[model samples]
Target: MKKESRQKESLGRILKYMKKYWLFLGLSIALAVISVILTLYIPILTGDAIDYIVDKGKVDFTYITPILKKMVVVILITAAAQWIMNVCNNKMTYNIVRDIRKDAIRKIEILPLKYLDAHSYGEIVSRVIADVDQFADGLLMGFTQLFTGVVTIIGTLGFMLSVNVKITAVVVFLTPLSFVVAGFIAKKTFSMFKLQSETRGEQTALIDEMIGNQKIVQAFSHEDEALESFDEINERLEKYSLRALFFSSITNPSTRFINALVYAGVGVFGAVSAIHGGISVGQLSCFLSYANQYTKPFNEISGVVTELQNALACAARVFELIDEEAQVPDAEDAVVLEEVKGDVDLEHVYFSYEPGQKLIEDFNLHVNPGERVAIVGPTGCGKTTLINLLMRFYDVNSGTIRVSGVPVKDMTRSSLRSSYGMVLQETWLKEGTIRENICMGKPDATDEEMMEAAKASHAHNFIKRLPKGYDTVIAEDGGNLSQGQKQLLCIARVMLCLPPMLILDEATSSIDTRTEMKIQEAFGRMMKGRTSFIVAHRLSTIEEADIILVMKDGHIIEQGNHEELLQKNGFYAALYNSQFAQS
Candidate 1:
């Protein structure tokens, strides 16, 4: 029941977009009605033409020609009306899909980091592109079939009843048996299709992972293993897809068989009625035509039901993404933080990515405005998690993180995030000109301001060497640039932001020591008045920090300046000595 409700809800959301083009859709529906009405006349006219031929007992052109001409006119008008309706349907369907795609893109922008992390890039991409495309095609087919089918069925039945009620009753009784078969098969197929959609998502994710990490796969000599893994996922997808298609395919034939039974029954019953003078031969002919027309729509609907099932499955996947519980809603009265003073305080903070698996517990910290703090830790020691909390990427499970004396939770996310500039170890650069990537943090930045930022980050020289300098379009994710160069561009982005607070996560790890010193010197200048949190593995990088935090597990085991921590000869001392001790 819940699954059915969700499907209905997904359909409702799709129809909401259709409401925008209601005028066109209504016109399409109106045209379909007219076309079906005109079509229904053809059977009646055909029957009349048959009767006229019988009455003449010879080929009398005078009587037959008029009825034949009327038939031709009706056929032509119905064809024309159907053509117009199709044009309207295509326009409305395409436009609706376009709008749906736009919404999916926008939803990706607002989705939380956790959601992005949980789902594979391939899975998300599949939902946005492939699934949506399938949904659009299915919706279009389903709409056309549904509208025409229902109209024809109703109109055909009404005409049949008029010709002879008894024959129409036989159709009504048998037609429902077709529906029962269709409904049972449809019920069986729905679960299969849903499983297929999920398997497809997993398969897509596997493909993306393999393709993106092809180098690693080759380096590890895991080609056969990768193929085996992919084959496993592919096999599952194939299994479910085949099952869904098999069951769905049964619907049309089963329904058609039932329709054939109705046709045969109509033939026998109508012949007996006509022989007994209960109905004329003309009425019998009309009833046969109406029976075909009536059942024809049922067959079309049965076919469309399969398509609709697929569409609903795809749509369910899409809605699952769009309906993801949005980032815990910001406090209603969340205030904007302007001209941030950069004082940061973490009071007995507790956090965990997963419940009962606490990564940070009873964490407390305080920093005066404009202080430079270096956080050093072993891998998975909550170093980056601290930054995530400070930046409000993930809220602390308990306790408060305050910036400039205001709880981070009390501030709007945009305003809070805008107050801080961040540069991470893994640099991200979109497909755009070098200048645009640097200016992304401040889109309205002047060329001079941008160039100054590039120079400060020591990225100016290499950028100047590029064929188009700052105007050079970087390939997607800066694939055209070296790792160090990409890091430099990311630094330049943070430099351009000039936020009052900075979070540098292995900010210079990619750079050579010499270039690192140059950028560090520039960072020294930039850090003068800004509250800076530097996360680094290299002990050499944090020597100048005003405060050094040595973290182990989830707790701050030591806090002091580099010189003081050295004297303590504890965890920080062992950590610092180990790096140079090997050399």
Candidate 2:
């Protein structure tokens, strides 16, 4: 999109959020108007005091007292009005920011898996935190100044014109030049600010990656390499930031110079009129004050043009994220999968993570209810990708995967996913008690039920040994627990879910031999009478599976039970023998 159109769209989105606070906004504007009027009256009173003293050619206490008193009262009222205006503007800005954050967060939930996969988590987090904060702060400063600045301009001009039209005309003519300068600099700075924002996100992503993998960096002795990489990113951010700020900084000086010319013009022209008797000395004083006030807003806006540009760039990014296409909608006739039987079938399925890659083509599979199917493959062999397709995280390029004769695509995602329980290689645990984490899959599960699930997954012993048992709060990502223990807790969660279809992808890969034996026993009990799909690198784990399929390059090269696959001496046999030899 063109920058202008994008900015307009972003601004329109911002205004939509502000629309809900119309009453407060109106009150803010009303207070600004009153403040501006009261403020403008001060210069008039000052001019009146000058005229009175000049006429008498002496200090007249009686005459000057009321004017001074009224000026003080007006100043007090303007101060009060400004305070109320600020309160309203702050309330409106924060409320709008709150809504923006809510929508952004909600959008992330519904976004397609592909989008999240392609973007780094740190970049998304930057948009949620740093970018949003920058936008909100800039908007607050811009709107507060914008409202009062505009009122000051209009009111100052009216008073100036009433004092002397000729001087008012001079000031008005020179004012647009200030905006022209500001606009030119703003145009040059915007693209730089955008680059700066992008660079900042990259820097944040690098930091996040490094911090998350600190152990690996230290173990590999790659601190120098990491530091060099981070320095490069930091330098890039600094370069872009310097260029953006340089261009933005030009606005203030250039506008100030233009303002200086307008002020000089008002002084000279108003003095000429006063001497010619075309306007009184008092009127000339008022005209000069009005001229300064009239041009001051332009200078004020110029001063914050940098902030405004940063806000716009940040807002554009925020709006872009909010407008990302969500996951494809469920079919109109989608059914709610319930009481699922374990049968699954795939017919002539074709899929690829990206177009033309052709990972899986013309694939077909059929498994009876309550069967255990083990998929064995090397890395990047589409092992987990197949599971992703089964869960509808990504729709197939073509063909259908059905459960119990119903095409999976015809079912709502929530319903389809609810029918299956999954435990993956990477474990995810939040900062909650062990019991709470296990109960996540079935929140209303009873204490007895949760304990039963924990015991079945072999997590009960560890829970009992913990300082506070199940009540001990897990730290972020279960840092307090071992990798094996975290995996067990995750398995416990799946056990509590009790779905008809179960997927175990490298569930025991990280565990020790002893733990694996216990987990395998737990899995054996859990897999009974349920459809199970196991993806594993350990050949021994799947020896008793009803069916074993060896995959290569997205194609199933060999299949059958453990004994049958070894007899074929095909891909499966080679894979099994290789792991057996290594062990």
How much lDDT does each candidate structure score? Answer: 0.89, 0.89
Residue range 472-536, candidate 1, lDDT tens digits: 99888897689999999999999998899999999999999899999999999999999999999
Find the candidate with the highest TM-score and give its number: 2
For each candidate, how many residue pairs have backbone atoms clashing (under 3 Å)? 0, 0
Check candidate 1 and list the clashing pairs: none
In model 2, the clashing pairs are: none
lDDT per residue for candidate 2 within 1-583, as digits (tens), equals 5987877777788889989999989999999899999989999999888887755558776878999999999999999999999999899989988998899999999999999999988888988888989898888988788888889999998888777788889998888999889888888877898889888888888888889989999999999999999999899999999999899778778888998999999999888888999988888888888878888888788756778788889988888899999998899999998889889999999999898787988778898999999999889988999999999999989999999899998889999898889999999999889888999889999999999999988899999999999899988799779998999999999999889999999999778999889889988988999999999988899999999888889898888999998999988888878878856
- What's model 2's lDDT at 107? 97
For candidate 2, what's the RMSD?
A: 2.2
Q: lDDT (0-100) at residue 48 of candidate 1?
A: 72
